[model samples]
Target: MTDEASAPGKSTAPGKSTAPQASDQYVQSLARGLSVIRAFDAANPVMTLSEVAARTDLTRATARRFLHTLVELGYVRTDGKSFVLTAKVLQLGYSYLSALSLPQLAQPHLEDLSLALGESTSAAVLDGTDIFYVARVATRRIMTIGITVGTRFPAYATSMGRVLLAGLPQPRLEEYLAAAELHAITPRTVATRGELLAVLDKVRAQGWCLLDQELEVGLMSIAAPVWNHNAGDVVAAVNVSLQAQSVAAQADPAAYLESVRRHVVETARAISQDVSAKHGDA
Candidate 1:
């Protein structure tokens, strides 16, 4: 994406190249390759040669070359009818998970939380405006949206995003606010920078955030920051997302979220203990 499309909320200032972009300068093949992978997602998983061209906005020939290159790299595959992804793509996400101490330790907690809360639970980190789900436990809900382990979401609207952003340094947080698009996804979406900032403050002060249909209709989530020994710096975030319909039908939203947040904190604490034990940090 042009630095203009540089993920969503985060800005790369003009003439101050924080992220590499192509122009009269130079095109980085590595960046382009990753962008190609990002372009192929749950929605656009299978694309024809022409569809890939339109989706990536690359010329048909350019798209074909990259597609073939990805095929050679074993990251993408074709079924003759259309192009699709392969399990080998998991290596990219697993590379990070394998190196991380938290995800490996907290995975069981996530599963337990999902079972207890009757909702999907995820551990994520802020990546630009998006939070990248590292470890997730899928749950069965009538309105459950299937977000795989490597899903990304807009921070300005997601429970995890706001919780994680609340942990960012002031300057970085300002940078994010200055560039956020704040697109409207639902009637309760926080599209203005002021609202986002206020919510971030409340998230920091309250130590958790409740996102009620901000990212999508019929979806509600509660997120809390995951910290290490310090309890100040947030290393990651954990969230429980449940169907909004279930919230109104079953239990009180505030009490439900409070219970879920407590479980998330306990899980994080347990994971931190495991990490410290493994790494001799204990």
Candidate 2:
């Protein structure tokens, strides 16, 4: 909802245009309406009309019209003074999820991984500058936030993001580096383009990524890229997350971490194989 990597008031739409808003294809009203929807997030789940206007940088009159329209559409509801999103809003995302096979394919694999490792496992895809979770199997609650199917985190500070970024083609990766606004999510976050590039280089060479305390204080994660049918490109990534204390409590921390990394990589490979097989049949 409130991604630290995103700049204030900037839309995180994938492939956002740098051209002027006056472009023929650019719909101002549509953009404004989406902005109104995005204004409600984890921090601000319910807001007044003026609060929505302030958050979206739209005038009260414009925000009101959109809010009323959303209410008429059953995506939003207002109890006279405040507005909140309804369950119907989830249908918008459900359409995308239902059409995507990756989540359905990866769900069982993630469940097995979580059961085996006694930790949380998740699969996610690159969305704009964020890693959007598509599937998750949680053994226990680790992070401060609840990680659901649609949770998003900045790509630069996450293991899954690193693996997905490493799988990107050179030109696309370069474009991302140029447009990405790097900021410190934590003290260990790779907040500079040059440093991030170096890390991605290693991830590309190693075929996986292990990140510690970059996204959160006590969380550690290892991730591997899920390849397409041809094994030519990464379609998604799978990861295992555990508390930092769990690794430290091990008699051999390095070996413990290495074991966890192996499991994550193996699970990713298994999922990739399934994807390839499914595609081959199709």
Q: Number of backbone collisions per candidate, in order? A: 0, 0
Q: Report the C-alpha lDDT of model 1 over 165-219, residue by residue, as the tens digit.
A: 9989999998887656676766878988888888899999988888887666777
lDDT at residue 86 of model 2 (Cα atoms): 91
lDDT string for model 2 (104-215, tens) is 9999999899888888889999987778888988776777656777776778888999999999999999877876778776788788888999999999999999988888
List runs of model 1 lying over 4 Å from the truth.
Answer: 1-27, 141-145, 230-232, 251-254, 272-282
The number of the candidate with the highest lDDT is 2
Each model's lDDT comes to 0.70, 0.81
